[model samples]
Target chain A: MTVFTLINISLLAILVATALTVSRLRALYEAAMLSALFSLVTACLFVLLDAVDVAFTEAAVGVGISTVLLLGGLALTRSREAVTPRRRRLPGAAVAILAGGTLVYASQDLPAFGSADSPVQRHPLTDTYLHQSQEDIGIPNTVTSVLASYRGLDTLGELLVVFTAGVAVLALLGPLAHPVDARRRDDLDLVDYRVLRVISAMLMPFILLFALYVLFHGDFGPGGGFQAGVIFAAGFVLYGLVFGLDKAQQVVPRVVLWALIPFGLLLYLGVGVVNMLLGGSFLDYDTLSSDPAAGQHLGILLVESAIGITVAAVMTTVFFSFANRRATR
Target chain B: MIGTHYVYWLLFALMMIGLYVVISHGNLLKKLIGLTLFQVGVFLFFISIGKVDGGSAPIVSDDVETYSHPLPQVLILTAIVVGVATLAVGLGLAVRIFETYGTVEEEDVLERDTTP
Candidate 1:
């Protein structure tokens, strides 16, 4: 077996082990941490599969943001899962086994792993996306080209879905309860950690800067707005964890977040509308400049920035909503 | 050969474990974690399908002869973001449920609802 295949199998085994452990754990906090480990392993597997962009995103969102969100949810609620009678386990196991059996049966017809002759690899559009994109979009990263241009409408929808989820969470949780006085000794914020405070304070600017670099460097590498936005939110989240949510809010207040929640979606829509006005189909960037490739580049940058804005704002808002809630026993 | 399709089998097993957790677990947070596992399993399946032998990442490079399919990566990319968004919403609901019913266990919440 090749080294890559060996690595792939090993990672998949780790993922399975983590998933099983997560399922068996009754401690919600431990389960959440294991889930983070699961995401970390999954990101590694994605890299092995030659999906660096997806791997980058999975690491940022799944490992970083999702873990923190899970922990925050755990803090707001109970940490231990309640025990129940085991009599009902039969049905769940039966259903899972039956469904899994069906999948295994169906898998007999699937293309072998890493086979070059798979239908997906053989499809005409694959060639177009991999080759034609260079001439048409003039971008080095085909994933970015397809995401920001060819499937721009789908991404716009995805952005809307994210925005809607943010709005829904905000409505459900309500706004952050008024920030308690910073000087008050409270368990909510880590006011006593001198080292964490100093270190995080030193790291905050670089974190934000790295996020911006990821956003702009996507055309040439393995990141884009989604990953960058999550990284950005994670930076603020780190700041909040150490310094306190109130300080984080002082930097990016609630009003600004509310405005930003829809601004990115609106900006994306406005770009499309402008494109229509310029005598091109909606979201066709060719009309944005005399040179089509340059226009495509400009349009992608704007839309990616718009995506970054909405995602960063929504993620921070969601984190704040969860963090600011008063824990009720 | 088993070697050719072992990944699929393993992924299906992982997905089934997630399914079992979602169904059998009473804790809302546990269910969400299960849901995440299930989603990630699916993501891996999609990404694995897009892989080509001896291919590199989809970033265009003259040195690389083959590139893994970018379409699936793009689809799963958005799906990951949406998955997290859904998770946030689910967690929010769990918190609200805990506030109203005083527990995140499904059976307890149902018992309380019926008793009231």
Candidate 2:
């Protein structure tokens, strides 16, 4: 077999193995770790499939932030999953198998994998985005152009969704409403690990710097607002995991996050409003500058920064809400 | 030809396994794990469909003539973020359920609720 085929087979095997192990493991911690491993493997698969951008995101958000959030949730409850009754397994299995069988059979009709003439590759939008984006949006990354310029409205909606999720978690947890209780401050500190503390302190600046790089360099590379924001939040999460939630909050207080989150969304909306007022359609960055290319660059930068701010704040807010709730319990 | 298409079968199997786990598990966290796996299965399937047999990554460059479809990558990127968001919300609810019921198991929570 060719090397590419071999690599694909091995990665697929690892993914399946990880999934099986996660399902069978009773310990939630082990399962969480395995799930992170699964994400890592999936990221590699994305890489193998020539999707480096997705791989970058899968690695950062999937493996890093989500794993931390899962662990945070696990902290608030028991580590061991209760034994499911055996009788409960049959119907779900049958239904799942039925669905699986239908899909597998249907796959026979799918165009051969990676065929050049596949419908997706042949689509007009694909050609437009791939060829015309350079002239219209003036960005090297077509994904960035398509995401920010072509589908700006969808992305704006997604930002609002992330904002809503942050709000919903805050409502559920009710931690942000109350300040960090001074009396319970001692209960949350984990100062014992001098090594972790020192390392996180050393790495925090670089992580934040890297987040900035990802945010700004998105037009030229795989990094973007979503990935940058997650990385930024992850830096704080690491700090929180090592030091304390209250300490991390001091670095980014709830009030600031609450204000900044909405502000970021407003910034995005404001950009579109300006575009409309400038005699262009909403989110039409072509009118933002004397030259349309320069306008695209400026508009994408501004909007991406907005997204970055909102996403970072939302993620950090959600993390704090969960972490604080765990502490109080 | 069948060998070339084995990827779909394996991915489908994984999807079913994930769905079965979600359905059969009593623990809310296990359900979440299964849900994530299911999502990943979809992601893999989408990414697989975008690949060109001898294509390179879709970054605009001088040397690469054929590249994988960028649309799926863009779609999947958003989907991944949304998946994590949904997972976060679900986990938050799970935590609340655990707090109220004193257990993460669905049947146990149900039993506790009906009794009260």
Candidate 3:
């Protein structure tokens, strides 16, 4: 076998090893850590594919933020608990098998691996962005153009979904600051949580800075509202993790969340309302202004900011629920 | 022959094992492991779909100008992040469940919780 082929095989083998390790891990904490490593490897594979934006999201969401949240959540519960397997496993099995079969069938019809000229690579949409994006959108990254301008409506739905998730979390929790049993409340040594405190103190600024950079730098690269929004929320999540939920909640008060919910929702809706009021149809930015490009940029910016606010607010709310489930109000 | 496609076969096998773990394992943490393995199966499938034999790195270099489409790789990366986030949320929920119930098994936790 060629050296390249050997390396690919090795990579695949490592992936299998990681999967096995996850299954065999007796400790919950170690399993989470190993899974985090697996995520890192998956992200590395993305980098090799030239998918830079996806790589960034994977790194931030998977290895960096999610792992922290899981570990923190684990701290609130049992560290290691043995639980036996249960019966009634057939329905899920059948579905998974059916799904697997369909997936295998789908793979059969796909073009052979690494075909130089696939339909997707040679599509008109690609050539349109590659050739004309500079003069039209004036963006460096084609992904931005597609996600922000071409497929903006879909992104709006995603933002709305995030906001809805926040509301759902709040609804599920019932009321804010309702008391649960004292024993259920985690009793990790708050005073001794020196590592978390120190790390948050160090990371909080860089996280926010990076979020902002991603927010604005999106037009020039593989970023925009969704990625930036998620990252910004991740920063607050970090704070919640380190400083304890109460302290983190203090920084981002309930009033802010209450206000932001409507504000973000209104901001996104208002843009569409404005568009309807103008000469164009709903969300049709031609009515936004005389210069279409200017209108597109404005629409993208306002919508993106709204998305960021809603995402940050909703994620904080979700984490808040996890911290204190008695939020009835 | 398609029958000799080791990568595809491996992917399906891992997928089955993951599904089995998720269904049979009573522990909350085990469910997460199963969920991850399942996700890894998807990731592998996507990567394999994007694989080009003799396909050099997607990065633009002086010597070689041609490269495979980098879009799928990018999508997979984002998918990885989303997968991790879901896992984190899942684990966090498991932790909270454990704290309240003092057990990580789904059946045990369900037995204690009232409908009210």
Candidate 4:
């Protein structure tokens, strides 16, 4: 066996261990931490599977943002899970086993792992995307080209889903209210840690800069608006965690977030409308510039920037909303 | 054959474990965690299917002769972000439910509603 296969098996073993442990934990806080670990391991597995972009995203969203969100949710609710009665557990187990058995029975026909003869590998569309994207979109990253240009409509839909989630959360939780007194709270911010404060302050600019780097570097590398936006929001989340939500709010006011939340999606839609006006179908980037490649590049850059803006804004808004509630309470 | 298929079986095990957690857990937060686990399992399964034995990542490089399928990665990439969005909404609802019901336990909320 190759070294990569060995590593893959080991990581999968670790994932299984973590998942089992997480399922058994009744302490919600420990469970949250373990879930973060699960994400980290899964990100490693993604790397082994040659999905670098996915690995980057899972690390950022699953480990960083999801953990913080889970912790924030824990702060608002109980930290311990209530014991499920033994009588109630049996049916769930039975159902899960039956479902899994059916899946396993069906999976017997699946192609062997990593076989080049698999239907996914042999599909004509895969060949076209891998080769034609170079000539058609002029990007080194097929994933970015496919996501931004070829399947652009799907991405727009995904962005709308994210925007809708932000709006839904806002409606459910209310807007992030400014803390009445920013300076009065002891428990809200980590006021006593001078070392953490100094480090976080130093790291803030680099974090935002790196986020921008990831945003622009996506054409040739394993990043794009989604990962960049999450990293960008994570920087603010770190700031809020250490300094205070009040301070973070000052850095990015709710008014700005409210505007930004929809602006990104509108910008994306506006681009499609422009495409239609320019005598192309919706989201057809070929007509944006004299050269088709240049048009694709410009269109992708604009669309990715829009995605980055909306994702960052929505993430920050959600974090602020959760933190604001705790502060006010 | 069993050796080649072990990964699928393992993934199925992981997925089933998640399903079991989601079904059996009473706490709203635990259920969300289970849902995430299930989502990640599915994501892994997709990525696994896209893998090519001797291929590198999908980034266009002159030196790499073969590349893994980029389509599944693109699909899962969107799914991951959408998954987090769904989680955020779910958490928001959980918090809201806790606020109204004064507990996040499913049985307690049901009992309170039925008793009243």
The ten-residue window of minimal lDDT in model 3 chain B covers: B53-62
DockQ of each: 0.89, 0.73, 0.31, 0.80
Better of 1 and 2 by DockQ: 1
lDDT of 3 by residue, B11-30 (tens): 77667668866876678877
Q: Estimate, for each residue in B13-42, the C-alpha lDDT of model 4 and write its tens digit.
A: 899889999999889999999999989999
TM (B chain), model 2: 0.95
State fnat for each of the candidate structures: 0.88, 0.67, 0.29, 0.82
Which scores greater on DockQ, model 2 or model 3?
A: 2
Per-residue CA lDDT of candidate 2, range A1-329, in tens?
Answer: 77888899899999998888888889999999999999999999999999888898899888888898899888888789877778988888898989998998899888887688988889998788888887888787887888888999988988888888878888777554455522234445779978878888898899999999999999998888888888898888888877887678887878898898899899999999999999999999999999999999999999999988998888888887777774424
Candidate 1: residue A275 Cα off by (Å): 0.5
Better of 2 and 3 by TM-score: 2
lDDT of 4 at A267: 95
* Candidate 2, CAPRI quality class derived from DockQ: medium
The segments of candidate 1 whose C-alpha lies over 4 angstroms from its true place after superposition are A176-185
* TM-score, structure 1 vs. true: 0.97
RMSD, one per candidate, in order:
1.8, 1.7, 4.9, 1.8
Worst 10 residues of 2 chain B by lDDT: B1-10
TM-score of chain A of each: 0.96, 0.95, 0.82, 0.96
